[model samples]
Structure formats: structure tokens, C-alpha cells
Target: MFKLDEAKLQAVLKQLHQAIYNHERWHNDLIRTIICQQPHDHHDMAKDAHRRCRFGQWYYNDVPTEVRDHQAFLAIRTEHKHMHQLATQLLATAATKAAIAPHDYDAFANALDRLRLEIQTLSREIEESLYNHDPLTGALNRIGMLTSLRALHELVKRQVQQCCIAIMDLDHFKVINDSYGHAVGDKVLSASVRYLMDHLRPYDKVFRYGGEEFLISLPSTDLKAGHTMIERIREELGKPPLAFHGSKPIPLTVSFGLAMLDPEVNVEETIRRADKALYAAKSAGRNCSRKWDAVNSTPLA
Candidate 1:
């Protein structure tokens, strides 16, 4: 039943092609600007400095004497021009694309019956993708988390380096979600994810374990270093009130449980220890971090 109007689709595709061509032309101009503005090796420093001072004075009255060099000013000017042109051309192309012919009314109506079926299939695929992500926070769902954990286990085994796992849960999340609608609760979850991503190192991985719970994996990190990193994230999340929808902001806090994997320990046991530490954190206080102490208790089975 699915159908795409051949004539209208072809027209739209051609317009997209033209827009792409225009973008390439603008990109070439930026390259040319960079080539033309580069300073010659023979240019004297003093002369270059004077030239820079002239341009610098034009742009800013408080230009520093040290920064007033012709070659340096030329480089800055070239970069600025290149960026400005690129942005302007991009906007123009977008505007042009927006003016492309709308779908043909007659063809679209005739195609609607087919389009409905096609859209339903696409929608189902999209829903399945969403199922693998936390609906509230847009982090990996529980199934996705387990898959990633297995991958990490394999990676650590091969590399023979220490890996740290931390479980994070928002303190008093149910109370917040209950007081506000599920919509606001969803916002809080999203905001928390953003905060964690911003604070964590680029190499670290974070996943939503389940509702109001999250997990982080830190590769090449020892217990002490991993503790320090989690502490920083906890402190930052606790300090600021998250703003939502122009209303009075609400305070947010997170508790974390940390566990480290020794090369000798099994991966499953390491994860179990981290989960235990998470429970410890919940019991000790709402906002704190607990690390697994192997000497005091039996290792995770």
C-alpha cells in the first residue's frame, strides 16, 4: 500500500542536490581565503606588527601592543571572514530549500492510503528504537546497559587494565515525580542526564540502568581516581537548582556507588559489588557515594 509520488519526490530531490552544490561553492571560498591570507616567510616582524596595529585599532580601541602584529591580524581577519561567509551561505541555502514546491495536493491525497501504511511501519521501527532508550531521560534502557556492560567486560579482559563501575540514582526522585506531573519528572531526568554528560570525562560511559537509576563505566581508572570523579559529579549536581519552564527552580542531588575491577576478579562479580555499594549509599544517606570493601565481605558470586 505504501507509495511515493515519483514526480514530486524527484523535484524535491533535485532541489536538495542544487542546495548541496551551492554549499560546496561556499566551502571552496573559505579555503581560498585561508590560502590568500597566510603571511609570507620574508615579512619582517616589525612591519607586520605595524600592519596589525592598524587593523586592531579599527576593531578594538584597547588592543594590546603585544597583540598588534600584521600577520596575526590578517590571520584573525581571514578566519572571521571565512566563518561569517560560511554561516551566511548556509542560511541562504536553508531559505532556498524551504521555498521548494510543496507536495502535490492531488498526488498526496491519492497517496495518503499508501502513505498511512508506510508511516505505520516506520513508526513501529522508531518505537522499537525508543524502547532501547529511557523514555524519561533518553539514556540507554536496561537491555542496552547489559549489552554495553558485556562489551566492557570483554574489552577490559583483553586490555588487562583496571576498570571502574559506578551506579547513580537520583535522591528522592519519586517524591519529585509525585509532586510534579510525569512531564516535569521527565524534565528532571533529562536535566540530570545533561548534567552528568557535561561533568563526566569524554572517555567515560553513562547509561540509564532503569527508572531514576543510572550507571557509569570508567575505563583505565583505579578505585581512588574513580571515587574522585564520582564525587565531583555528585557535588556539582547537588549545588545548583535546575530551572524548568520559567518556574521557580528545584534543587537536585545524586547518590553514587563505586566499584573497581581487579584484573583477577570476574566481571560479573565486579558489577555485583558496584550494585551492593549502591545499596549502601542509599542506606547511609540520600546523597553520598559508597565503595565496595572486599576485605569485609564475600565477593560477589
Candidate 2:
């Protein structure tokens, strides 16, 4: 049941697409009706119609139509279209310049083609994962986590992977903001994340969990190794104070909670266990790491 046949997948995707199309058509038709019945408010009707577009909505019930995922998706397509337009113009210029002067303009044409290829490659990457990074900390955001966890679950089902998730929270982050201002707090979060990335193995992935928390996913790592890794990261992170704007250094520490994947248990359940362990770490003390379901669980220094 985990892997759907191509026909089944096609059917499901087709149904989803059809539903979106139907909703869009309905919205447009309603707008058309309003255009005839209430000509004075056609502008408002048009705006509402776009706002209700299914493809642009995060959730069905969610209003305030500025969906980040939708915007990101559109931005990717728009940029690609713009690049294509540029390439077309470049090719046309190359033709004109060839007639007008020497063939040096051919280099411009070649570069334009290469740029087109790169843009296509970027589009493919974006399709594979929505929004590659968090703008602030340069970590993978929730979108990356969602896409990666799905693929990781597939590998785990094949018994070919042992991935653990570690959730870490900045201890007393609000106090940092209250003591030094939000700008300094922001710098601390970014610096702390940089420390985590620098300390962890290159293959390990870090995603911004929320405002001052992060989720580090360690592939081919079990619970015990994950615990050790998080402790090491915590130790390294505590060694340095975040230097903000080159003025002064602000001390920072993070608490971590970890959970290993159980093939029998769902990923959400595993994450919830890690979340509980995080709560335990926070309750015990600030700067520490803990693993869920550990016997005589003690906080790591």
C-alpha cells in the first residue's frame, strides 16, 4: 500500500487537478455573473476570484491569499519564463549582430543558452522540493522537511535507512531579545544555526523548526549516535558567543531532543516523541540533549 501503481497515481493526480480546475472555473464563472449583474464591483469580483484560486491557496479554509508555497512556485515559473524571454532576445541579437559585424556576439548567444540550461536545472530542483531554504538562517524550512521526510520514509520502509530526528530549541531566546533587542536575537539564532551546520557532518540536514528551534535529520544514524551527535553540537554551540554587528558577543545555548524511526510507528508519532523529549529537556534544565523512551534518561551536558 505504500507504493501506488502508476495508473493509480495518475488517477489520483488527475482527480486533484480536475478538482482545482473545477474550482477555478466556478470562481471565474461567478465573477462573470457579477460582471453582468453588478458592473460597478467587477474589480472586487475579479480580485476575489483570484484570491479563491485553488492552486494559490495553502489550505481550503485559509483566507488571506498570500500563500508562501504558491508564491514560491509561481516565482520559480515566472523567473524561468523571464529567462526564456531573455534567451530568445539574445538569439535574435546574435543573428542581427552576425549580419552587422564580427561573430563575437555568438559568445553572448552561447552564454544565454547555458543560462537557460541552468534555469531549467533550477526549476527541476524546485519541483523536487518546494522552497529550498529559510531566508533568515539558510537552513531548510518546513517545505524541505516535508518533502525529505516522505522520501526518507520510503527508504526506511525498504529497510535501507536508519534516520533520526533531533529537535533543538534555543534556551531563553526571548530573554536574549528582551536583554539585547530583536536584531541581536536574530543574529544569535543565525550564528547558532551556523554553528550547528559547521559542527554536524555534511550529510546531516538541518531545517528551521520554527522561530528559535531547528530540526536536524541524521541519515544512517540510530538513536544513540544521534544523541552523541546532538550533545557534541550542543557543546560546540555553547563554546562561542554570537558576535552581532561586530559590537559585542551574546552568549547562546540550545537544548536538544531526539527520536529514532520505528518502522512500525508513523513518522508523526516519532516526531511527537522527540517533541516530548524536548519538553523534558526544557523542564530539566536549559542547555541539554535527551532522547525519547530512554531508560533512566539523563540530560547530556
Candidate 3:
């Protein structure tokens, strides 16, 4: 599943390079038309000219919805549209054999420059996101996890917001790895993380804490809400056994240990509490969620 995501990022980078080349060709064509004092029959003169260009066709029709919804992509769309509108004005003037105003040409040039910047920004963002994520599962790795959790911890200390962390472990993952080959185990891990990510809210963060385990960060959530959220995901994973290569479907179940961010201690201590709760869940039969009770230093299912 994440392989597809990685491929999409690579494809987007390739397409972005092509987009620059396409725009350059279009710009050169416009320059040639101005120099020859001739108006060519080109789609660049249309009000919706951005939608007619080769790059625009790919962007509007082929790009993923998630990529299209990005801030940099949105900026690129705005700049592209604005540039085309200016180009249409310039083309109309040139067709009448009239001199093009300096300001008009400058506006088009500026828009083109801005569009290129936005494309570069989008490319950089995609690369960074891919870098931060675990190659096996698309969930974020531990690279920046501590720093992020610490920041969230400070907010909790300030009473600005509530945050919870859950440590989730796949039940008997080693059995799957031993029963099937590691390849199949890898497949299960990938599929499970993908499913978990799909069910989570956009703002929530999931980290690949270690093999067969994940850490879920639920921002602006208390212990109860975190338990509810983790429980829902736990139930979802129990059904719909994973299918592979037309063989028997492999059943999957996950146990979760939920704990609120403890303002009184370091984030690591909080993680320890969650880990203890996870241990409690495992001991009390897997496939369920348990929450840490700070007062009793115990976990409750």
C-alpha cells in the first residue's frame, strides 16, 4: 500500500520537472509570437488557457486528489490561472499589431515565476514527508517523535489542550512471521498500518514505534476519548482477515494501551505508562483497549 504512495511521490517529482519544461516551451512560443508580430492560433489565449496546456491537463486530470489539495498545489493553480489570463491579454494586444505594455509583460513574468516557486515548494514537501516516514509502513518513524511529543507535552502542562498517546501491538505477530515467511509478515504489517492510517483522523499522527508496534498520538483528546478511538480501530482490525495471493486469509487483531499526556513527568515517563497499560491489555487477553489509571498506577480495560 505504501509502495504505491512512494511511487506517487516519485511520479509527482517527474511530472513537476516536465511541467517546468512545458511552461518554458509555452513561454518561448509566446516570445516568438511577439517578436514576429503575428498572432498564432494557440489555446494559451483562452480565458481557461491553464486547463488546456499539456501540464495543466496532467495536473487537473491525472494528479491525485490529496496532492491537488495541497497548499503549494493550490498556489500553483492560482498562479497558473492568473498567468494565463495575462497571456490572453498580451496575445489579444499582439494580434492587433499593437505594442505590448511593459507592465503587462512584467505581470505575466511574475506569475510564471511564482508558479515555478510553488511547484518547487510542493516537490520539497513531498520529499520531506517521504523521508520522515518509515519505508516499510507509511507511518512516521521515530526521527522527530520525541521532539513533537515534548511540544505537545508542554501544551498539556500549560492546560492549552489535552493530548493522549496509545501504544498498539499486533497480537501474536511473531507467529505470523514464523508460520508464513517474513515476506507475508511484511505484507501483514504494511496492510495493518495502512488500515490504521485510513481509519485515523487527518490531524492524528501514527508512528512506527518498533517492529509490530505503533504509537498513536491523539491531539486535543483525553483518556476517555482516546480509549474510544483506539477501541473502534481495535474492533475494525478483528474483522476482514487479510487475503494474500489467493491463499487462506490471515486474521489480524491489535491490543491498545492508552494514556493521557502526564503534565507532571517527562514524555518518556508517559510512554512508560502507556507501555504498562499495553502490557495489561496483553495479559488480560489481547484485542482490546486498556487505559492507564494514574491514581492507582494500574491499567483498566
Candidate 4:
């Protein structure tokens, strides 16, 4: 469900590190040129030096298209271009045996600093995304599940937003595995998670909660709205048949238990409440949804 391009992320990170190293070498070369007052005829002295360098070649020609839209990646491009512009100016002044102004050098230094910072920020973000997502489903895994839900819990506690948690289990998942073998079962799991991710809101989070269960976090949604959203998902899931193993159509269904984030309870307690409701849904029928009734400590009919 996560649209994270793992191959793209890895490739970008590798090239980014190489780019950093190349820039460091360029910096040293520039310093030597300025100090020695040498006639350096390299492209580093050109106005379009940004496009002439190794990093520039990768950025323009080889970097993955997927990562280009990130805020940090965009900032890196701007800062990199600015730094090269200043470097070119400095090189021109140094070649003439003229004194470089302190202000001019400071501007170049500031630009370089910004470029470094943006590169570092982008690397951290990519690493975090890789760590938090499940390798199989590309959904957020249990590794950072509590930390995320807890932050939302705090927001609800402060009355900043309404949030709900839903626990969904694939109906008769074991039967699918037993009937079709484990390979087809994996395909079913992956396909189902992708469907859920596609249908969910942009801000919503889906976590693979082990086996055939997934947990969805619905932000800015109250109990009633959460039910409506999940009901729609359940209905839609039934409408489409997943084609697995050379166009063999297989139908799938899910049982959901939803509960609003309660300010007074711990986040785990809220999850348990949702799980309880999920059990109620499964008991009533395998392909239905239920909401937790906090006042009565039971699933709402």
C-alpha cells in the first residue's frame, strides 16, 4: 500500500552520498585554485558548473524520478545550483589575481551549508521510510506503530482532532491459504493491502498487524464517520474479484472493528477496544463491521 519506491530510494541515497563526496573534492579544488592563484581551465570555473559536475550529471540524468518531488530533494537542487553559481564567481575572481571579497566568500559558504543540510535531511527521511515500512506490503509495520498512534493519542487528548482506529482481519484467510497454497496466499495478502491503501484517504495510515490483520488509523474522523468509511471499504472490497495465478478470480472479504480514540484511556486500551469490536464483527458474520460502544464496554449493534 505504501507507494515508497524502495529501489528508487536506495539508488538515490547511493548517488546522494557520491554527490556529497564529489562536492567536497570540488570545494578543495577551488580552495587550492584561490590560494595558488593558478589558471584553472576546468569546467568548475564555468557559469553552468552545476550541470558540469558529477553530482549534477546524476541529478539531471540518473536520479530517480520518484524522489525528485520531495521537499528536501527540491531544496537540494536549488541550493546546489546557487552554490555552484557562487563557486564559479569565486573562481573567476581568483583566476584574475584579484582579492576575493569577504562578503562574496560568506555567501558561497552559506549556500554550501544549506546544500549540506538539505542532503542530510533527505537522507534521514529516506532511511526512516525504509525502516518503518513492511518489506512485503509496503505498509507501515509494527516497528513504529505505537509511537505513531501515541502521537495521535496526544492530539486527541488536547482536543486538536478526532481520530479512530480500526482493526480489520481478512475473512477466512486461512481457508484461502489451505485451498490455494502459500504462494497464492501471499499474492492475496499483498493485493488486499494494496486495495485498502488505494481506497483510504491520503492522510490515513495502514499498518500490517501480523497474519492477515491490518490496522487503519483514521485521522480527523469521529466514531460515526469512521463506521461510514469502513463500511464503504467493506462494500467495495466485495465488489471486485482479485485475479491471482493466471487469471483465476478469487473473492475476498474483511471483518472490521472500529473505536474512537478515547482521551481517558491508554492507546493500547483503545486498540483492544477496536479488536473487541472486530471479534464481534467476525462472530456476527465474517464480512461485516462493528463499532465499539465505550459506555457499555461492548460492540455496538
Candidate 5:
């Protein structure tokens, strides 16, 4: 029988619910505490009231939300931006050397009430999105990627069409992490994904295939076309050296192994062949693309 890890899911839900509740409660309490002690030296406290709530950072930075719910993702992100704006306003109010402004308090209170409700809405959406995405770089995770590949595989079987899978790996990725630190390595990984996403056709998809690698599927593409597409991606990615957080820019390169879908073979076999080609690319020299050799495989297999 097919079963998801229900207990694990429930634990995650409980944690998220508690996080939202605690953030809402704590922010309100802080507001009340600051407003009460407003006779002297209270302005500074009021100004920093918003900074006291760490829930948003905890949810975004600590908690992983790889769900595919775009609406939920956008809603939560919007709320996060607004929360910062409101907090900054409160801080500025405290910093000002004047009597407490009635308008400011009313505005802050109304916004806080809206945020209290927004958190619940965001939690619901985040739950839906988590099911089909990668929490780290926001790409479709392996499972999600497999689902789409399955559909494409079926299409290849039923109709006369071209398909190819390109297995791409970051060359010297561990060295990148060791030389620059893991944080830069992470940025590079995410940046590589962005480049693929930007260059790929609308129907094409690139899935995270564990670690600094991805499996990009191109529907309606022959080996020639797929090669061209991936080469373009390589050209774009290798250039414009990635600059992390205003530090000196570092160059990143990738090697690709490509295999065309064979009508007589299964998708997995084609992937295996593609992976072989990828290894060849890296072996030849990093940062080049190689195609699977079908002629050799026919005799070996």
C-alpha cells in the first residue's frame, strides 16, 4: 500500500502552527508592554518593538517550505515584506523626539490585526506548496521531477516524438565549497538552477537530481536540438562570473552528459546512458557537453 509519512507531516504542521501563533502573540504582547511604559525612555523601546519578533525569520530561514503552491508562496513572501515595513515604521516612531502620534498607533494596531490573520492564510498555502518543491533552491524536487518525466515517457511511447535528458553537474563543486565556503557553493548551485530555468523552453523542465546536479528533460527535441539548447545554457552560465553578496566574482562551469530517448529502450536506460556521457564530458575536460554513443551500446547491451 502507498503511504506517506503521516506522523512526520503532522509534526511539521504542528511546528508551523505553533510558530505562527507564537509570533502573533509575542508581537501583540510587545506592543502592549511598550505602550504601557511610554512615560519616559519608551520611544526607543517602541521603535525596536517590531525587531523583537523572530517568527518570520524562523519560518523562512529555518523551516523548509518546498511546496508547489505559488499563491501561498507569494502570500507568505508579501506578508514578510509588509511586516518589515511596519516594524521599521514603529521603530522610526520611537526614534522621533515628539509626543506619541495617535495616527501611528492606530495604523500599527490595524496592520498587526491583519498580519495575525495573514499568518494563518500563509500557513495553509505553505502546506500545499511543500508537497512538490525543493525547500533549498525552490526547484521541483526529484519526486516532482519524476512525475513530469513519467508523463513525457508515456508520450514518447504512444506517439512519434523526440525527447532527451541532459544530466548536468557542477565541475569541481566540492572544491568550490572548500575554496569559497559552503555558503558560496549554495549560491552557485541556486544560480545554476536559475540559468537553466531562464534558458529552457516553456515545456522543458529541469529537476534537482540530488546534490549539485540536475536532470533536464527536453520534449520535442532531438539530440541536435537538445545539444544546442544545453550549449547555450552553458555559454550563459559560464560567463558573467557570479558575485556573491558583493564579494569578488567567481567563475562557475558545468559539464553535461546527454542521451536521446530511444523508442526500443526504457527512460531509465536512456538516463544511464546520458550519465555515462556526462562522465565522459568531465573526463575530457570540465565545461563541455557530450552525447551518448548509441552505436557502441547496441553491441554491449
Candidate 6:
């Protein structure tokens, strides 16, 4: 008469057991409610009497019984009560298990995992953006230059690329601040950065190394190519004097030191050598680009 197969029959039985346990717990709650309302009454005995009378009316009326038959009927009644108690406990446990099933719990776990991954990804992106950007000039900062330098060094080691590191410093930058005020001096610095960026190749990177000093990293370039680039920037900056606050334009000039990285040298030492060449350029006359000549002891004139 049942639609279910053997396995489904077992599952249905389990579900019925749970439903029976829930019914028993509900009945118990009713008894507790009555007892609590009338604290002095022995209400459990009265409840059992009521239930037995109801059961007799519903299923045991008009039956004539022998002595053995009556005894068997009493045994069946006892078994029914025991089964009700077992069903009550099973129903409670089943409800709790359903509440925490894999379907419910796994969704929550997956959401948390996604949130954590997004947070980490955003944090890494922010760090990388800040690493290469200069706060003042909006050019690459010193740390950014170093990162590019190291990459270039590796490329050269593999014989895959040639690169030059050129250092540029504004001539008499401190004098501009002293004579024209720091605001004017800042404008000059900004203009100088723009001038350098305007003339350089799109692949080139410029860094704000220090106060009034900048570094240029040129990939796929040799010493001669680097010198040509620096000369162009110097000429551009000298062409028109930068003006501030609608006043007369002030003359702006920069000194440069160009050096190609030796394949055997480390990135830091290569930058240092370029810096020494810059010092030599400044000592020479201030508005010139000088290539590092180790054999020539005399500084540029």
C-alpha cells in the first residue's frame, strides 16, 4: 500500500519517529504549564488518567476479553507509552541537526572566505600603488627607482637589455628659495619635473631622489643615448624661463650625470657611480651633462 521502496521506508520511519517525539514533548509542555499554574496540585496523575480514558474511547470500546487477552492488551498499552517517550527524544535531536546542516553552515563559511580574500587583494594593490609614486612631484620616488633599477640589472645580467641611470639636480635651487620665496621655488620644481617628462621617452621612468634632485631610468639605452636624452631635457628647461604669480620669468637650469650600468656591477653601486658623475657636473659649471670618465682624474671645467 506504500509508494516508497525499502530504503525510503526506513527514511520515513526515521521521520515518523521524530514527529512522534515532538508530539510527546508538546504534551509534556502542556503538563508542565498546568502544574506551574497550580503549584500545589498533583497534576501528572490526573493527566495520565485523562489520556487513558481518551485512548479507551477512541480505540478500545465494546470489546469482550478473556483473561489472557486482557493481559496482552495491558502489555500493548505499556509498550505504547514507552514508544512515545523514545519518539520525543528523537524529534528534538533531529530538529537540532537540521538547524546546523551542511547546506546552511557551508554557505556562511564560503562567504567569510570570500571576504578575507578580497581584503588581502585590495591591501596588496594599495601597497604597490604607493610604492612607486612620489608624494610631491607625482613622479616615481626613490624606492620606486630602486625597484626599476633592480629589474633593469637583472635584464642586463641576462643580456636581454641595456640601461642607463642619469642623475639630475637643479642648479642653485636653494638660491631660488632664498630670493623668490619657497612658493616660487616649489613652482620651479614642478615645472622642472614637467619639462623632463615632456622630453623623455614613454618607457623612461623619473624619480624624485632628493630635494631638487631627480633620477632617470632609461631601458634599452646606452651611455651615448642617455647623454642625448639629458642634453635635450637641459635644453628644454633652458629655453623659456618659468614664471610664477604673473611676474617676470626666472631662469631655470639643471645639471646632469649620465652613466651606463656595467653588467658586473650591482644596482646600488651603479646608482652611486652615476651620483659621483653628477657631483662632478655640479663642480664643473652647474648647467652641463657629464659622462663618468674614470681615467680622467681632473673634474669637468
Better of 1 and 2 by TM-score: 2
What are the per-residue Cα lDDT tens digits for candidate 3 across 129-206? Answer: 678888888888898789889999999999999999999899999998898889999889988988888888877888
C-alpha RMSD by candidate, in order: 17.7, 15.7, 3.4, 2.9, 12.1, 28.8
lDDT of 1 by residue, 1-301 (tens): 0012334334433443453354345335433433354332221123333123322233344333322332332344443333343333333333344431233323323343343343344334334434555555555567666666667777777786768899899988888877776788778888888678667776677787778888888888877898998888888884667646457686678888888764557767777888888888888776888888777753221
Please give, for residues 6-25, the per-residue lDDT of candidate 2 as tens digits: 34434434543554465446
Misplaced by over 4 Å in model 1 are 1-135, 244-246, 262-266, 298-301
| Model 6 pairs whose backbones collide | 21-87, 21-88
TM-score of 2: 0.56
Error of 5 at 49 (Å): 39
TM-score of each: 0.54, 0.56, 0.83, 0.85, 0.57, 0.55
What lDDT score is found at residue 73 in candidate 5? 40
Q: Candidate 5 has what TM-score?
A: 0.57
User: In candidate 1, where is summed lDDT lowest over 10 consecutive residues?
Assistant: 41-50
Superposed on all Cα atoms, model 3 deviates from the true structure by an RMSD in Å of 3.4
Predicted model with the maximum TM-score: 4
- For residue 174, model 6's alpha carbon misses the true position, in angstroms, by 0.2
Question: Relative to the true structure, how large is the alpha-carbon lDDT of every model?
Answer: 0.59, 0.63, 0.85, 0.85, 0.69, 0.63
Runs in model 4 lying further than 4 Å from the true structure: 1-12, 40-42, 45-47, 69-72, 201-203, 238-240
- Off by more than 4 A, model 3: 1-3, 24-41, 61-75, 90-118, 244-246
Worst 10 residues of 6 by lDDT: 62-71
Candidate 5 clashing pairs? 47-91, 67-129, 67-130, 68-129, 69-129, 257-278
Residue range 1-301, candidate 4, lDDT tens digits: 2255677667767877898788788788878888888777588877778889887887778766667766667888889999988988888888778899999999999998998898889888787767778867778899788889999999999999999999989999898899888888887887788888888987899898888999999999999999999998888984667646567777799999999889999999999999999999999977999999999998985
Which residue runs does candidate 2 get wrong by more than 4 Å? 1-130, 244-247, 294-301
Question: Model 4 misses residue 196 by how many Å?
Answer: 2.6
